[model samples]
Target: MTATQLSARALLLDMDGTLVNSDAVVERCWRRWAAAQGLDGDHVMSVVHGRQGHLSMAILLPERPVEQNLAENRAMLAAETADTEGIVPVPGAPRFMAELAGLPHALVTSADTGLARVRMAAAGLPYPELAVTAEQVGASKPDPEGFLKAAAALGVDPADCLVFEDSQAGIQAGLAAGMRVVGVGPRAAAHRPTVQVADLTSVRVTRDADGGLLVAL
Candidate 1:
């Protein structure tokens, strides 16, 4: 494949499915929750990715009270954080991170700070110094709030930022935030990001002359 080049002043990255392959833990926990609620596991899985737990629950069980979803989400987060089995970095993630060293970048993930920390540690990936977790945002993916916040924190214009995501919601969020998106992994391909790569191994990043990023995918 011919590599497509993208230029950006800063990069915003999603955690799960992008940097860390936490599907095993996520599926285990969410599927258990689905079974408990008498919901189909496949349906539940469809809504859980790239969004906060409480939000996913609210979507899956709309009739349930917000308080119940919030409480359950707290428990789910705790359970996921405690279970690190099968967690690993996505292919080429370590090299990807190393390439971004000294560049402007921030993690924009639906996971809370605690969950994010735990998963990143479990995957053996370096946690970005700047992160906008669920707790830092008023809305989840598809709202563009998190991505916009990360861009602001990085002191980059939204239009000058590139987002790395691996879910439909996340790709929508990046586009809504007026940034270009690099969809990562199989799940992201159907969402129509600016570019799609099987994994970080298909990507190459370097510093441009103007101190921006030159990402070739």
Candidate 2:
């Protein structure tokens, strides 16, 4: 696989779709929820990825009350975490992440700490030291709050951050946060990322003696 070289001071990654493949559980849960609400599952699926559960719910059922959306989001989170069937890391995710160990990076996701742990473990991936979960951000993806907060926690400039995202909302958030975005899959292409890669498998990064990384795209 060929990749263009790039430089960045920090990496900000999305958890579920980008690093881990929890599609089976995610879609199943959402599909059930859509059925319960009489909403179109296809539309719900289109809007749900990369956005917080509550945000997805609100988008899919705009006429519903906010409190109801919150309550349902909580239930969905619990249900999704309770089942790990078919949950696994995305292709090349572990290897790419292993290479990024000891580097300045953050796991920025719509899932909170507990769900993040369950999914990451199910996928056999490492937990990031610096993470910005849904609980920490006031707003969800397409808002840029998560990515901005993660970059701040790492003490890195937002412009110096490279974000790996698999959702349109996540890509928008990264771009709005003033970071370079790498689209991680086919879905991400619609967001028009700085670069698009099939998966994390081909990603390579090397540390220079000067303490900077030369990312091999």
Candidate 3:
């Protein structure tokens, strides 16, 4: 069978693991929370990626009062925003994103706008013009709301979108949105994305003669 390149009207991307390498900051915060809640950090980490803080809190500490989870989620968000000491762009991410500037692309992430801005700044990335953060969506990843919202914001059909995601929840969201998804990391490959790549470095996007975007890997 011949390998076919993906072509799309727009691109949607996940933030934390896909565009930015925030592993150290993420693990630190989640581990600290797990320690405080007397839960296993590894288990907690496994369920947290690509999820909103409140959602992750609810999943990890279900027995806690809803109010308590809300409060801690706020705290965790603040801590993550403040803890940008080790955050950086994922390998090939900066270059890939730089090329995407002026293109039809948006960041659709589980992180709220504030947290997204901080992390993007930490990673030295440009803020996307159309970002659909957690605050804008009725539901977070694992739900297609965010991705759908992004596609709408770009005035494109979901089928004409290409999403790059690094977490299972994110991959699932992209699939549910009816967009072609490119899994961008080791963990994402297990989710069976429509396309799988080690990282954004290998993927290339070019504008065709007809002004359409073409994605090749």
On lDDT, the candidate that comes out on top is: 1
Per-residue lDDT of candidate 2, residues 70-170 (tens digit) = 99999999999898999989999989889989999999999989999999999999998888998898999999999999888999999989999999999
The C-alpha TM-scores of every prediction are 0.98, 0.97, 0.96
Q: What lDDT does model 1 reach?
A: 0.94
Count of clashes in candidate 1? 0
Candidate 1 TM-score over all chains jointly: 0.98
Which residue segments of model 1 deviate by more than 4 Å? none
Pick the TM-score winner: 1
Number of backbone clashes in candidate 2: 0
Clashing pairs in 2: none
Per-residue CA lDDT of candidate 1, range 143-200, in tens? 9999999999989999999999999999999999999999999999999999888999
lDDT of each: 0.94, 0.91, 0.90
RMSD of each: 0.7, 1.1, 1.5
Pick out the ten consecutive residues of candidate 3 with the lowest summed lDDT. 1-10
The alpha-carbon lDDT assigned to residue 115 of candidate 2 equals 95
Report the C-alpha displacement of residue 130, candidate 2, in angstroms.
Answer: 1.0
